[model samples]
Target: ILGLLDDSPECRAFKQQLADLSLIYGKRGERGTLVTKTVNPAPLLETLQYYFRQPADFLEKQIHLWETERNERLQSVRKTLQDYPQDVVEKFERHLKMTENANQLRELNNEWLDVPIMNYFRRLVQEFARRLTESKVLEKTIDVYHLTADELQEATAMLPEVMEVRQRVHERQVEEEKFANVTPPAFMGAYPVDAVYTLDPLTLSYLNTEAPNPVDVPGGLGAVPASPGKVIGRAKVLRCTTAIN
Candidate 1:
């Protein structure tokens, strides 16, 4: 897409994340689309940066809340330990140390985002904000997904419809966010079938044998394999969606 005539570098989300520029594109069903709307790139860029500020802003709030909660809990632990006998107090102190270790491990998700994933979600917010701001079709950056190719083609033409669809998406997002223990579905399909095929960039190959062979009932769909382990699922998350409390 980098070399494509219509798909400018900024229009591709992955590329946009690197360039910090909005890409001009929308989606239509199962197809990729190039954006037709045009606007002053300068103001659009500013709007995007401001939009991107939201995640970091929330992070600041989260850090303050986390610190407040952590201190309160640590103090509670100390208070509780003081009333206990020596043997119990030692055990509680040991457990407190273990709890601190666990909290540090949790930082791998919270404060220490790296190239692998948590950081990528932040990049997604930036990229989506850039696209929506440049296009000027939606108030919220995430509402960009509510657009169809035809709707985006005319820029502001289908905005009311776009907002209606966005509300629906937002509602679903809210419901999904409320799910706790986060409901793993009854089963994900075997790989190379269902969503797994479309998810992978490389062309997939499956059973090609024409001869009829007796088939047996497949065993239970279970845990990820021990070696070269794989789990297949796709999920979309928004900044508000990730908050535990």
Candidate 2:
């Protein structure tokens, strides 16, 4: 942590957490290192980023200065060659061409360096590749550059005409969210909602089944209300949630 700058609110927050946790849990097995303090690295990071950029700016300025000097040198050599003997003029042209060739190569390299987009894209691809590899869905990862833009859009977008059933449901949810300002219906009858598919160290997928007893498990939210009084035709009872979260 950089001691030069004042600690920000975020640093103070985590420092408090470390103190609280140490007091609450003490040392693990009575031999573990006690959580004593938190270090704020934001100030150090800011200093490093600015300090490195200073040298880079200086080098860029030097390149411009060198180009100006190289042009002046080439003009002076060509002008003197025009008045010299034929042999001298030939040697001067050869020297000029050699320097020009080296300068052109440097110019091309500079062009490549100026293209910061490639650097940004490379970083984006690396992070996406890492996430895909960690997910282990297809047991491997592919370059994001190879994936079409449309595929990425489909994964995030919830257009109404999406073909996938999961996407269609997702689109409906998106539409429902727009009306979130409209509070849920009054606290009457069973306003059964979605099922919570929580990971309890095993496959507890049967958290919302009904048929057999309909009201066996209390934690499973039991059965839907009987909708007493008037005989409201035969509408859906929604005995329990259908799908997973």
- What is the C-alpha local distance difference test score of candidate 1? 0.48
- Give lDDT tens digits, candidate 1, residues 1-245: 23342375445655445344333221111112222222234554567767687875786898899999999998987896675556556656676676567543443432322323333444555565565556554566766555555544444454433323455557666775788548677778765432221211111111222322223347933322222224244423434755633
TM-score of 2: 0.21
lDDT, candidate 2, 1-245, per-residue tens: 43432378776676566556654442222112222222344554688677786865787788899999989987887885565556556655765576567544443332333333354465666665465445431123443344445653443244333323334445555676788768876788886564432332111222333323244465655643322223323334554587321
Best candidate per TM-score, number? 1
Provide the lDDT at 206 for model 2.
24
Which pairs clash (backbone N, Cα, C closer than 3 Å) in model 2?
none
Candidate 1 deviation (Cα RMSD): 23.2
lDDT at position 142, candidate 1: 62
lDDT of each: 0.48, 0.48
Candidate 1 regions with alpha-carbon error over 4 angstroms = 1-7, 13-51, 55-58, 102-245
